[model samples]
Target: MLKDSFGRVATDLRVSLTDRCNLRCSYCMPPEGLQWLPKPELLTADEIMRLVTIGVERLGITEVRYTGGEPLLRRELVEIVQRTAALTPRPQVSLTTNGIGLERLAAPLAEAGLDRVNVSLDTLDRDVFIRLAHRDRLADVLSGLEAAHRAGLAPVKVNTVLMRGVNDHEAAALLRYGMKHGYQQRFIEQMPLDAQHGWKREDMVTADEILAMLGKEFDLTPADPRERGSAPAELFLVDGGPYRVGVIGSVTRPFCGACDRVRLTADGQIRNCLFAREESDLRTALRSGASDEELAERWKAAVRGKRPGHGIDDPTFLQPSRPMSAIGG
Candidate 1:
């Protein structure tokens, strides 16, 4: 396995297919959306495939996750998934989506050999959903979630970002709902990804608060984590059936110790951490006439430079050059 300086294996990769989106989340963007990536600068499906090939072969990557501003916004998403499915080892494929376009593409993506999905749904209440996402499409998102279920995306998980006053109340309810429906509800604390949005540290919802609420209702017995550098969310069954819940304390309680994943953006930059101040511009290398071996050499240098951890817990966070949208979630 490929181990970084943190001793975290680079087994999972989150690739951003595109930075364009259909909905604007309040935390992720300003009222005026950010400028879109230049058409000429974005990685083509073929170029993306070449990188994925390298990631699996060179980085010991076994899990390939497709993320985006909204992945389905890319016209070539199906092609990407298809090509990934055709990879030699057949890496476990997953997608993180906004759920707006999931209804149309879920089953097709599943048939395309996509393994699972992590849908971003911040609130169950319609008004709250609209308020958070700046769009009145809660019903549509819910419908898309149902469509994902119908599409055989078993163990479909919902990723909720907990804003201070926006959706914290929904946390416990989301847990109950997850338990009732066999879905894994993961609550992630907010973190500053870019300076454009002006995200603040005070706005975070800590995992302790989230667990306290669940501890009141159900016993959150810890399950043995499946693998090294798997996930921050300590797995637990919510007292009834096998319904599971995950909690990622990236901000208030950062889990940099076992951080496993690396991000490759739509524009082809390799970021070592979400709160990264620097990135290796793969797009520049690819477009500047670098050979495959040279490209791999550049990648090697970047991987060797991975930090032990972001160390966000120690009184600092990097002002990232890119936003969460550009970070591939």
Candidate 2:
């Protein structure tokens, strides 16, 4: 088990296939976009599978989430999901995408053994989406969501980031939209994960505020905490029972104490924490012919050093050098 000094064992792994993204959300990167990793620097499909095999067979990973600047951009993603689902004690495979190409890839990915998906859709309005993502792809995203649902990706999740004075007012409407379409709505508080370092606390829509906004429209009762477990989202039973909504209060109501996630970058570096300033390089070792055992040990070592919390409230906290896109969401 990848047990940290804090006694938290990592069972979930987030793997970034590439740092390239199709959308340039204002919160993630500048309109011009940041420099992407060269093709040569990224891990090959074989390399990625080898590491994933080690994690599942040797390190006790039970859930594998493929992420990226936009995971749908990775050409080999279907193959990756197929391979991951074939592992012994097969992990629950999922993808977090901007939903650009998902309209076409959803059925293929589901057939390839992808268990589910989380699509990021901030607003229902096309104009707001254009202003936020700097792209006119809202139609593609909605179509993708429909495709994923039709492909039998049960409990299709929609991730929304409510920025103050932006799409915050659409909180109730977004939830209604999700409920109407059988999609689970999750509102995540914006964190300081942008490459431009432009995140401001005041500009963020806090969890409390989000709940208050929804409260006015619907009666939200906290779901059984026992069911939440190590999941980042704090779920609420919408309209009494059955249907639900979630809020990931990453900054205001930190869940780091129960965090069970570890990240693998496209370049094959291990990130023990999302906000970590340091990384454990596995790409160099893999390219240099390191044995799987050695690589597993390195991964274990990385998780062993995980900090207790993200420390955003600490005066000394520094935003990670890699943006959310590069960090695999």
Taking all chains together, each candidate's TM-score versus the true structure is: 0.93, 0.99
lDDT of 2 at 34: 90
| Alpha-carbon shift of residue 244 in model 2 (angstroms) | 0.6
lDDT of 2 by residue, 55-109 (tens): 9999999999999989888899999999999999899999999889999999999
Off by over 4 Å in 1: 194-197, 225-229, 314-316
Could you tell me the lDDT of residue 7 within candidate 1?
Answer: 62
Each prediction's RMSD to truth: 1.9, 0.6
* Full-model lDDT, candidate 1: 0.80
RMSD of 1: 1.9
